[model samples]
Target: MTSINVKQSGDQPNSTHCRWQWRDEELVLLAEKAIWRPVSQELFVADLHLGKAEVFQACGIPLPSDDDRATLLRLETLCERWRPKRVVILGDLIHGRLGLTDRLRADLRNLHRRLHAEVMLIGGNHDRGVQLGTLPQHPACRVGGLWLSHEPEQPIDGRDGLNLCGHIHPTTTLRQGPDRLRLPCFAFDNVEQRMLMPAFGELTGGHDCRHRYRKWLVAEGTIVPWFDSAHSSRASEVGR
Candidate 1:
């Protein structure tokens, strides 16, 4: 089993972040559902799905207008605080072609201009080969020794790596017989050497994680190590 060291970050005294030693690298799991590489000074977030609320509104399904704004604000806050050398977004940067609005575009452009770091995006299925406004899109890229992409690596196709990916928008459920709740989580597949990021977007749906991937729940502005309900003993054993 791969060794992992987890600790609550004192620097983030509010408990908004945790420092994790995964493999040979140090990764910070932020309450924003993003990853921070202290050594590289790089910030990684996934599945922003910006403009999703706007797209829903277009379909006559009413959703609050602030989703886009709230998401952008989070991104801006992360960038400003971390001041990373670059910001890497895993995938699904925007909800759909329909999500694009003049205001959204302008806000994105303004955010781009204001950020001092380089921005990189990997287009996802929702992207449909369409770039995020004027942002550059690449099929995949390597950063900080990890295969960074929107989708998970397929070993059968001969593609594999210590990958950092985001498309699944992983979540775990808690049920108390009549009550049930779902929470977003980051999942790690040790054998595959993949770290699956949770959706960074507010208006997003999620898939239950595969049992093989141990999970870290992003809850209540804290990153919590969570063992599987069915196999709590095994999950805890592996996580430790």
Candidate 2:
């Protein structure tokens, strides 16, 4: 288990929202912690570190054991709400071999059956340590002229389609008064034509998205635009 220092995120109640547009495709960024592609009717999520709590508990870190269940339920909820035809898990579906348990496997199979959506996984670093069955070991996947990956690596020169990835577990810091809140975010690097997704697991920590790109912070049940630079603070907020 990676001994990462976890931060408790603030709770905000809001409807599932935060939509964006790219390449003539409408992206519905659900507060449920998934991206809904309207054109393909697919949901894209990343970095679900299932069974991470068990790993931490084994390492003497006091963490709740329900982390895996919570993560799975959240995904199920999104599926029920959006009714996507398919769900594309970017990477790191499970934490590692030790984290992969029979119970977890059962839950995954059950969820797959319940959602009845074609689930595609593009393996990530953690997934490399285990045999996740049928899912490809390829570093990237192509779907509808878009590149889906676990890491945000630039494509070969002039490669067509934009790259969407998750690994860093990006987040944005919002300041109000003397306090600052670190919230999960979607980091879009317009310059690189790549987007970084937030960690979808409840027990997962986050990487502060300090890169110089636009970000959408999940707040008050909606997605708000967070400008890393004072220059872009004048932009409008984006959400449902």
Q: Write the per-residue lDDT of candidate 2 for residues 1-240, one digit (tens) a residue.
A: 223222222543344576678886578777666788988899999999898887777778888788787778778888898888988999999887777788887776665676778888888888886776545456686777578999887665456767889999987655443455678988888888888888898888898766477777775567655543552342212210
lDDT (C-alpha, whole model) for all candidates: 0.78, 0.75
lDDT of 1 at 235: 40
TM-score for each candidate, following the candidate numbering = 0.83, 0.84
RMSD, every candidate, angstroms: 6.4, 7.3
Model 2 pairs in collision: 14-221
Residue 149 displacement (Å), model 1: 0.6
lDDT of 2 at 213: 72
Model 2 misplaced stretches (Cα beyond 4 Å): 1-15, 134-138, 156-158, 231-240
Per-residue error for 78 in candidate 1, Å, reads 1.7
Model 1 TM-score (2 dp):
0.83
Q: Write the per-residue lDDT of candidate 1 for residues 198-221, one digit (tens) a residue.
A: 999879999977467777878778
